[model samples]
Target: MAGAFEEETNLYNRIVLGSLLPEGAWEPLPHWLQGWLRNYIGGTLVYFISSFLWCFYIYYLKRNRYIPKDAIPTNKAMLLQIAVAMKAMPFYVVLPAISEYMVEQGWTKCFASIDDVGWPTYFRNLALYLTIVEFGIYWMHRELHDIKPLYKYLHATHHIYNKQNTLSPFAGLAFHPLDGIMQALPHVMALFLVRMHFRTHIALLFIEGIWTANIHDCIHGKLWPVMGAGYHTIHHTTYRHNYGHYTIWMDWMFGTLRDPEEDEAKKM
Candidate 1:
């Protein structure tokens, strides 16, 4: 584990930071600081690039088919969402940076390589890890809505985009900094409960950016069990259903799942 961590540090310094920073500039900082910088920069890039691509494809290219002309978020709303996300991004990346540092220090169940365990065991652990994260995030998110003070303060910033028309991909991360962190804490916490590939953990964290954007697009993909924009759109409007992340399993189990299909059927 120690050897792998050292190798990773060296690789990041040489390939990532080395290409971007002067030799003397970053060499003096500690390993954790370097990891944080890497996460911050990488996360910012993922947020912008993914958000723009999703927005462009949906809002520009296929706007007529995917989004309602009257329901489209105004430019001002998108800009505000972007601004809020930018302000919270540094803090949002901190959890992953800390998780990376902790994994390096051998404090987590994060394994340096999948070779340590066979493919079957690795996948089993991954399933367990995801399960823990799903359960934790569902409850955490539900409480953010159920608790009056949490909603009034931290979570309320995101509820501004409550209606379908006001929601867009940009609204994904447009959260109060602490609110975002609290929601993301489950991913990091899962590392302690089950073994996970270090690289997989990092990849999943970044995937959250894309997943959130997809959920906010307000286009129902009709992917069952998998929580698509259709389910999430209902969550935004009703506020009392579909609190599950990644999947509807938790919400279904907990009796909070609301099928978007049922709503459409009623309209018909």
Candidate 2:
């Protein structure tokens, strides 16, 4: 697995960075720096592309169905969300890059391949990894609101888009740099807690960009266990419920879950 990772990264550096940097310069740089560069480029591209695609589909194509036309955020609002997110992105990518470096150095419980631990143990470790990450993220997110100082300083940047009219796919990553890292820190921390596939961990971190965009689109997927945009929009408005990350189980277990349907019933 290490060999495959090294080979893939080397090829990426040569093909991508080589075109821009002086010939051979990218090869001589340390491994961690190379990973960070790759992460920054890939992360930025995913953020922009995913956010734009989701926004185009929901805000334009399905606007009449999902949200009232008057409730849509203005073009300027979306651009501001994009601007804040872009500024914070360089910092946000650092966490995963550092995690990759740790895995390469054998500092974390990241396995090189599934064969190294066999299928049974690999699946077991995979379960543990997800549990740790989900639990950690739930608490981290909840505390960001529970603790007044943290909210005032860090989480407030995100809460600015606390309305259907203000929230959009672009608002998903429009957080203070540190705020974004704090929320994502669980993914990095889980590496030390349980064994995980090096590639899978990296893939999950990128998946977060897509997930966030989905939850901020103000369209309910109604997928049980999944924390869809319906639940998240309630969090934006009320600021006191539905603090779970990928799923609502954490909020449900902790007594903070607020069903979107409950909100609907109140209107009647």
Whole-model lDDT per candidate: 0.88, 0.87
Off by over 4 Å in 2: 1-25
Tens-place lDDT digits, model 2, residues 1-268? 5566566556666766777667877778787787788788878878889988988887888878888898899999999999999999989989987887677667887876788889999888888888888899899998999899999999999999988899998898999999899999999999898888887888899999988988998888899989999999999999999999888989999999999998899978
**Quick one: best lDDT, which candidate?**
1
TM-score of 2: 0.93
| Model 1 misplaced regions, further than 4 Å | 22-24
Pull out the clashing pairs in model 1. 71-165
Error of 2 at 247 (Å): 0.9
The digit string of per-residue lDDT tens for model 1 on 45-150 reads 8888988999889888887788778878888989999999999998998888788778878888888788899799999999999999999999999999999999
Candidate 1's displacement at residue 176, Å, is 0.9
